[model samples]
Target: MKQVIIIGAGPAGLTAAHELLSRAKDMFAVTILEESAEIGGISRTVRWHGNRMDIGGHRFFSKEDRVNRWWAQRMPPQGAPAYDDKALGRECSLTAGGPDPEKEDRVMLTRRRVSRIYYNRRFFDYPITMKPQTFRNLGLAATAKAGCSYLASCAHKLPETNLENFYINRFGRTLYGMFFEGYTEKLWGRHPRDISADWGSQRVKGLSVSAVLKDMLKKAAGKKQEADETSLIEQFQYPKFGPGQLWEEAAKEIENMGGVIRKNCSVKKVHTEQGRVTSVTVQTESGTEELRGDYFLSSMPLKDLVCGMNDVPSSVAEIAAGLPYRDFVTVGLLVKKLNLKNETKIRTLSGLVPDCWIYIQDTGVRLGRLQIFNNWSPYMVAKPADTVWIGLEYFCTEGDSFWNMTDRQCTDFATQELLRMGILTSASDVLDTHRERVKKAYPAYFDTYAQIDQLTAYLDQFENLFCIGRNGQHRYNNMDHSMMTAFLAADNLLAGKNDKAAIWNVNTEKTYQEEKNESGEGGAI
Candidate 1:
């Protein structure tokens, strides 16, 4: 049997293990080495006192049927039960209260996406809809200025070089300055002009000022678009407890399928002979051990992977070290439901704007975004009726002051910022607080990002080594996109061929065609 070594048990690594073990159990010996004790990397949910918090919100929706089917096989939808829960000593009931007690293990909840931009102490539709309330809030003067700038942008037609130009080309200067400037700067710690246009293209590719206006016009006329745009998807599925449940179940299935998984095993070095990887050295509680493998897959950060190599080239090492990342902090504040209702002047706790999250576009505070965990799912909070949990996200560099702040200081700062933004009336409203800091949360796309192409090309020379996933590829891919890359890599391994080009071609838009070979294995085209 051919031995396979997988690094990092995130969505990509787990997906690769599942695919390989399911397809060729007798032919391949799969072993997964995960550095962290948990299954999910950034996608894992943190549980505290019967409350679950998604580090960042993960919406399970993908145009790829394969990805959807993979998730469905593990966590089925509510109505269509995948297994007989009664066999597991619980009844399955499809009711308004939620799935039956037994079905809770595999059931997924469908939630409508509701996000708004909180700017200038007012909430506006996230897609920038042309509504009376939006116009009234902006006032005539600012509205006219935005309109004139948009018209001038159309007339001048500036070339889109950087993020600033990309937004101006689409939404014009006035709107970009008001909506995109501060938020982008705060998120990346750089001016929009200094950031690469690739970030804008990957993030806000479909939506534009004209598109929103046209959609609003079509809505008024009671018309619908023929194509289903993924960007404008209104609803998505999520696990009952949190996204971590999906991967945890997947890890169990892999182990049951005769695949070995070693948690808390940190990879120290990847030993390569000539142009192919031969084995990997990992540090565990018992000390270091070397595992030999015919094929190796890495989902660790590209920089670390390059530096961890036995004898990497100086040029490659320099380029890898130059790649930057943006760190993140989420300060979860548990507040009294009654206090929040009174401050917002809403009739009931449920009356508060049903937004899963809100973008903090206001320049008064350092907060980049706010997530309403209760709105995400009632199960996210311990007591739905008595309390609400809000996540205040702040983006900063690893050693920056914001990231260096102690947990108490971060909680205190977030609480003060919430009051300043009028989310709460007083400090006494806070019941409890939890802070989570994530390093290298986002792969930075700056002017120096062009060096990535050289680095990728150099790394591709290794025949048996595959680098796939967000941080592995040094690309800011969403969860599904990362899975797609892994899927392609697994297909290559099963087919006994290397298809690095096709694996790298999986773009941010998730628009890649697949074809089956003579052996009936899926391969990306």
Candidate 2:
């Protein structure tokens, strides 16, 4: 039997294990080595005093039917059809312990999405809704400026070279300066001009100022707007408890299938010989041990993986080292009460709006975003009536001053920032606070991103070495995209051939198969 060693217990690695074991359980021995004690990497959920907090907000939505089906098979959707007790040859009723369908469907929950942008002490529709209230807040002067700038942009288009140019070309200079510039600079810690247009193309594709304006006009006229595209879906499925529940369930299933998962095993070295990965050396509390495997899959950061390899070309190492990542810090503040004081009136925070999260676009504050855990799911809070948990997200570079701050210092900083932004009246309103720092939360897509192509070419030479997942591939992919790559990788392993090109193209637009017209023309209908 062939032995497979998978590194990192994130979604991608776990998905690969589940797929491989399901198909070739008798022919392959699969073992997963995770550096952390937990299974989910960034998608993990943290429980504090019976409340759950997602490391980063993850919405389980994908345009791929296969991806959705894969999740459904493992964790069926709520209210999906199930075998009745009579059909299962059971005499007792469901209430009498005869197979309760609701109990069986415990993994996923359907949720509606509500997110808005909080800027200049006012809230705006996240996708830029135009309402009388929005115009009133902006005043006639700013509104005219935005409208004129958009008209000018439509008449005279600018060349889209970088992120800055992309936003200006689509939203015009005035709106871009007001909405996109500050928050983006805060998140990336660099001017938008330095960032590549690829990031903008991938994130905000199909969205344009004209489209938003049309939707707003329709809303103002009391006419129904067009349905949102897949990229702008307003509803999604989520794992109960947290995203961690999904991976934890997968880990249990893997163990049941005789696959091994080693937690707290840090990979120290990847041993390669004869242009193939022979084994991996991992360190644990006991000591170091080398495990031989017929195949290897890595979900660790590309830079660390290349550095830990036994022998690599200097050029590859240099490219890996040059890859940059943005670190993340989330300060979860537990509050006893929240009050919103606006010019019109002072009111309790409840019943104002149901927003899962709010982007902070105000230039006066350093906070990039705020997540309302309660809005995500009531279960996210220990006692929804008594306390609310809000996550203040900040982006920075590793080893930076903010990243190096102590937990107490960071929490205090968040509290003050909240007060400064008028989200909190006083620090005394906070009941408790916890802080978590995640390194390499985002892979940088700057002008230097072309170096990743070279790195990928070098890594592809190793027939048995497969790099999958976000940080593993050094791409800013969504969770579903990460799983898709893993699925393709498992297919390659099952076929006993390396198809690096296929794996690399898994999430790109070019990989999507367009529908055929009646005349057999291959184009999207």
Candidate 3:
């Protein structure tokens, strides 16, 4: 009998398998079942036209130094062969008197353009960068109106209980409307007030009005740019290929340690008896195989996990069904030619938009965030001038047009939007287009998220069954956080500890003190 049965091939599952076997040194058997054909879950990168493009935009920023070093050590013994850092030149060219035009294009395919918030038929500088730019966008008359609104917002700036109140307290009505309202509303398919404020608090921290004003003042003078320098807080790490490469490599490591990763093997049913997991029936190419295991670690979606369980109480099943998720559809377009503009050289578009991911605040535009894959890694796509992949991320419900649209329809829509926005000249520039619809990609944090406590209580009845991962725990965690949860779970199992709820709550702190020491440099890699 396999010692452990891991129910997903994502980073969390792979990490769990690795840590389990590595710590024990072949003390137990482990197996992973993945519904998809490949590893990495949403982090998986698909090969399109000989180029690798991610499911969406994935950045490698992490607060943990060990996570950073783990990646550095795992990547191919040698880093990607040195390309002449031409993209770096283009990034520098974004500033005045930076790189020469000929040298910049020789290094990069395109230059990064300024990203603005489009709202109420006007574009505004996001993060409220410069007072002059903000005033220009809002106009003198509107600025006065915003000032009056800001005072009213200040009077009501109590501790926020919901997402809407949080934003209203932080940025006031006008700024929040122009910058956050539409895109956020579209992302969750719910009002900002209906969603919990915890999501907002965690995602955006340390950026206050005073901080932005200070950064803008610093930029206006000849002083060093605080925006670029302090934005990331510290360094980040990425795989040579793309974000998916990390999971693929981790999968290889797990297999190397004698653990089996069964791809395209879907879990049909999870049989339980007396609140303990009994056996898991998987559907492979052959047929259904009931694999009995002493322990089960499921990284699959929480709703699907509960649905797959046999003979569960109907009330518990209904509660699991009540947990909602927001889906995402990404349209990846490969464009021909690199330099669409003459002046600036675009390397990566991290802050080009609102966040690293641009928010489409305009109601008229169908796309949400636009991620330039070439910015993450030039090697992400096949060739430079000939083919460059741009990811148009649109969030929607399962029934939304973006989700229900045919692949061809999405690709056409993306192409048309690129032309409409003047990002591309015509359809002739588009070499190839692809669209991927991800169902239940994000756990929607509604006002009723507290109801998850009831669902978690039901799962707690199971002695040997554990659910760990982003969707597994129904927590919006990043890659390292998810992997760390799995690692902690395996440790608990090995230690014969039953407290698993604590594992789900990892990465809860903002500006974690444990991740770094008093000295600003990394603690340990």
Candidate 4:
């Protein structure tokens, strides 16, 4: 039997391990190395004081039936309405004879995708819908300016050379400045002009003001819009506890199939013979061990993976060392309630704002986005009926001033921002708090990223070494896209299809890359 070594116990690696074992368990020996003690990577759920926090909001809505089916088989959809739906007397689509979420923990619940933008202490439709209330909120002058600016943009399109122009061509300079400018800078820590237009093409594919207006016209004419459009997607699936539950279940299944999962084991080095990978050196608490593998699948950061290789060209090594990444910090706040009101007609528990998350577009505060944990899953909060659990998200570089602040100092800084935004009245409103930081949470699109094609070409020479995942390819892929890469690699390997192009080509089609998502919808990957 050939030995298969998979690095990084993330969704991509776990999916690869499961697919391989399920297909030909006796033909391959599978071993998974995870750097963290947790099951999921950034997709993991953090627990604090009996409450669970999803690092980033993950909505299990995908255009791919294979991805949806994979999720359903592991955590069956709920046959009965969930707690919030039952309490609110709300209706939801359910699967027949599926597990009951109220009685079982291993069930998936149907959830509405309710996300909005908070700018200037006002709430607006995330995609900037055309409505009287929206215009009223923007004020008559700004509305007219925005309309004229959009017309000017439609007349003379700017060359899509950078991320700023990419957004300007779609949303117009007026609305782009009002919406994308400051918040984007806050997220990437760099102006959009410095970032590549590929970031726009990869994230908000085909989502433009025109698309939103067209969808509005269809809805006004009594036609139900398709879920494929970013603005019109209304429903998605989520595990009963959190996304981590599904990954944890996947990890267990991998172990039950005679696969080995080593946690707290970080792969520090990859040994290559000629152009093929021979073994990897992993570091653990006790000591270091070297394991040989016939095939190597790495889901680690491309920068780390390439830098740790035995030998590499100077130019290739320079590009790998110069790869940029954006770190993330999520501060979980258990508050009694927020000052924001539920003005919308959508009914929610405790008459709370129905938004699952609000993109913080106001540049006054450093917060990039905020998540309401109660709306995610009733089971996530310890006391959902009374307390509102929220997560304040900030993007920064590792070891930066913001990232280097102590947890207490960070929590206080976040609390003050809430007060400044009128989301809270005082620091005492915060019942409890927890802080988490993740390195290389987002693979950035600047610096040496322009020469990535050259790097990939060099790495592809290693026939037995396959890169699979967001960080593996440094393409900022969504969760489904990441899993698809692994699935294709595993299937091709089983069929003795050795060419690596198909594996590398997993979400690279120009049309698909520019039209499917708007940067993963500001949700979990």
Clashing residue pairs found in predicted model 3: 109-338, 111-345, 111-346, 112-346
How far does residue 310 in candidate 3 sit from its true spot (Å)? 3.7
- Score each candidate by Cα lDDT: 0.77, 0.76, 0.67, 0.84
Which of the two candidates, 1 or 2, achieves a greater lDDT against the reference?
1
- The lDDT of model 3 is 0.67
lDDT of each residue in 398-424, candidate 4, tens digit only:
999999999999999999999999999
TM-score of each: 0.90, 0.88, 0.82, 0.95
What is the Cα-based TM-score of model 2? 0.88
RMSD of each: 6.3, 7.6, 7.0, 3.4
For model 3, residues 170-256, the per-residue Cα lDDT tens digits are 667876676667777777778887888876655555444545666667667866743223232322334546767777777888888
Q: Report the number of clashing residue pairs per model.
A: 0, 0, 4, 7
Among these predicted structures, which one has the highest lDDT?
4
What range of 10 consecutive residues in model 3 has the weakest lDDT sum? 516-525
Clashing pairs in model 1, backbone N/Cα/C closer than 3 A: none
Worst 10 residues of 1 by lDDT: 516-525
